[model samples]
Target: MAPKAWTTKEVEAALRGQCEGRHRVAPGLYLRIEAPKPGEGGRASWSFRYQINGRSRIMGLGAVGDVTLAAARRKAEEALLLVRGGADPLTLREQRAREAAAAALAARMPSFREAAQQHIESQQAGWRNEKHAAQWAATLETYAYPHFGDVPVDRIDTDHVRAALNPIWTTKPETASRVRGRIEAVLDSAKVRGWRSGENPARWKGHLALLLPKKAKVQAVEHHAALDWRDLPAFWGALAARGGAAALALRFAILTAARSGEVLGATWAEIDTVQRLWTIPAARMKAGREHRVPLSDAALAVLAEARAAGDGEGDARVFAGRGSGGGLSSMAITMMLRKMKRPGTKKPWTDAAGETVTAHGFRSTFRDWAGEATHHPREVIEQALAHGLKDKAEAAYARGDLLTKRATLMAEWATYCTRPAGAVLPMHKAAAQ
Candidate 1:
């Protein structure tokens, strides 16, 4: 039987017995079982001997334990198949290994700017709006790209991150904070995609927090100068006197007590004239929740005027800009405020601080009025503002929008705004003072 031609059972027995020399398992596959001589352990390894173009070569088929008896034979057969096809198996394996190494090196070579762009491209669709996408690109272009645009993502360190943040850390703390967060996001994406490996250099809580002063410590709380609740009647009167799309939009914003961005981004499709409701989508609202604002009679009239001003063109934007695309520029209302003179003076409509009142300030004014003047529940007032509840339990249970109560409240608010200056009486003792 020619010694049974070296079966798997024979090979295992020989390896355990510490066979001294190589023994053939197949035509070209051989197993070498080593004796525990000197510091060496009892082990066995398989090898494939092949002749390519009359040149003999030996290729390792891994260790006996790592490669089973059946696996070793399979590898030996594959090697022989390659030799028959006029190709060297050893050279092909080396080539594949080299290609893998090249791919790994290439992945690590992308610059910080390149990686940031890729990350933005991958994530922009999921972002709530285009303005956020623009902000992501703008911050990297203005701050990070200037410092380390061409530097490889894997090589970014504490120094690189600090360099980008240091200049604006104190001077422009708000912008700098956003830039730091964005850089961290891009670097995190790089690490997750296997383009880089290391702790994020721009991390905030434990890492960059050590390098920079707390944002609250270095940055002053600059409130947008709000038109006083007392002055709203007069302000509304003056705003009504003006005639333009921006003025109408500003009036609607005040009547609705909505954010400037929300008011500006309003589209015709979002409003239901029959329901007297302006439903801002979750994507447009900062709270990431849909908010239905009860449209007051004054608010509806403002929309009518806006439609007439645009010659009833049927544009999608409620307050369309000068051009064919996009809604009103956020600054348009601010610019109108800048140009408007106070009731009898050459001075602009300034807040108590003597600074120009911003479009956003109306929301603050609304909050103060709703809190002090109205008998509405605190939750209803907060709901009208589209504010998230600070109390977890309250937020969990308070799901109803209280839309009917809100409608009554908003109507009373609009009526109060349209009242003559003399008809507006003080709601609290301090106001009378």
Candidate 2:
């Protein structure tokens, strides 16, 4: 009825019993029948045959040694299903293959840049400084963003990351390394989340180690500016002219060797006027331990003035603003300096190193003065500054606030900071006795 289907029995006899030449009969009629090469190892393999729009179509199956004779027959029969459906099995397979390839490529996958944003979001809480968090994100955004930003996480390789970093790696090694590590961290996160799967092309120890030079080999870089010691008098005088809470806060930062945020965030509750002490909470301390600042008479004087200006309300901040509307931000003190460059102002404060000093640099001045001019113990000076104790015993058992000692040290420090007495006077005769 259907042109009498071809029989495998007759085909076998045709190839094996009839021709008796070198040609090997592969499965499917008029399919691929190749002369076995010596290196082919006498293994039989499957081949396919079908028809499409009255034309012969053929396809290759895997080695017959890998697939049995019965298996090859079954494959050929399945291939025929496509032929019966008015589709060329070979052409259909190719079209389907291309469609699958296109579908895979079109799949939505996270890029390296997106992975970095996710990583930052997941870990923002642990960072100490909010500015540090900004720096962390911004560095990647600026440097690595253009190179690897659009690259799919799975497609990222060692060279792509290295390419982004190599431009700055030699000259600005520290920053470059940080950028590299951040990229690695994001990729690692991707791997853990199953977004990517591969050997980490970014790992520093076993892989990138072989390519890039060690970062630690390079010398550390310095900041843009520093102050000279000889110019303190004029700078101190200029500071005196700003003359308000901002000026006071700057002076306090200098006087205590504390950071700007610490001084601005101060509240009245922290000060015990009767006891002449300021107990900074552990959360506020850079060292994450409580620090008691001993108040000098001058410091107490400043506090009293601040308190008088504040509402008699006990909870009032010694330095309050209208709730983030106009408090002393980090820019506040820096802006005050820039204003000093205004016409009719005398510029002061050049460092021994011959650069303009910054708001934070005053701490260095105070530390230098403490070392050169005062007799306070190094640990006591450090304790007064609320620097965490390096000494094990002091760190463990010295729980009691050493406010009295700090008060005395700060008073002595304040004496050095303020104008010297008009003239040194002799002690009275009774005091001499």
Clashes within 3 Å, all models in order: 0, 5
Judge candidate 2 against the unseen true structure and give its global Cα lDDT, from 0 to 1.
0.68
Model 1, residue 49: distance off in Å is: 57
Each candidate's lDDT (Cα)? 0.86, 0.68
Candidate 2, after superposition: displacement of residue 256 in Å? 1.1
Candidate 2's TM-score reads 0.60
Q: Which pairs of residues collide in candidate 2? A: 45-64, 227-351, 228-350, 228-351, 228-352
Could you estimate the TM-score for every candidate? 0.71, 0.60
Off by over 4 Å in 2: 1-107, 125-132, 170-174, 198-216, 219-234, 267-292, 307-326, 341-345, 383-404, 421-433
Model 2, range 141-259, lDDT digits (tens) per residue?
Answer: 98888887898888998879888888887889889888888888888898987788988887899888888889877647655344443345456666766665667777766666676
Write down the lDDT that model 1 would get: 0.86
All candidates: CA RMSD in angstroms?
17.7, 19.6
Error of 1 at 281 (Å): 0.5
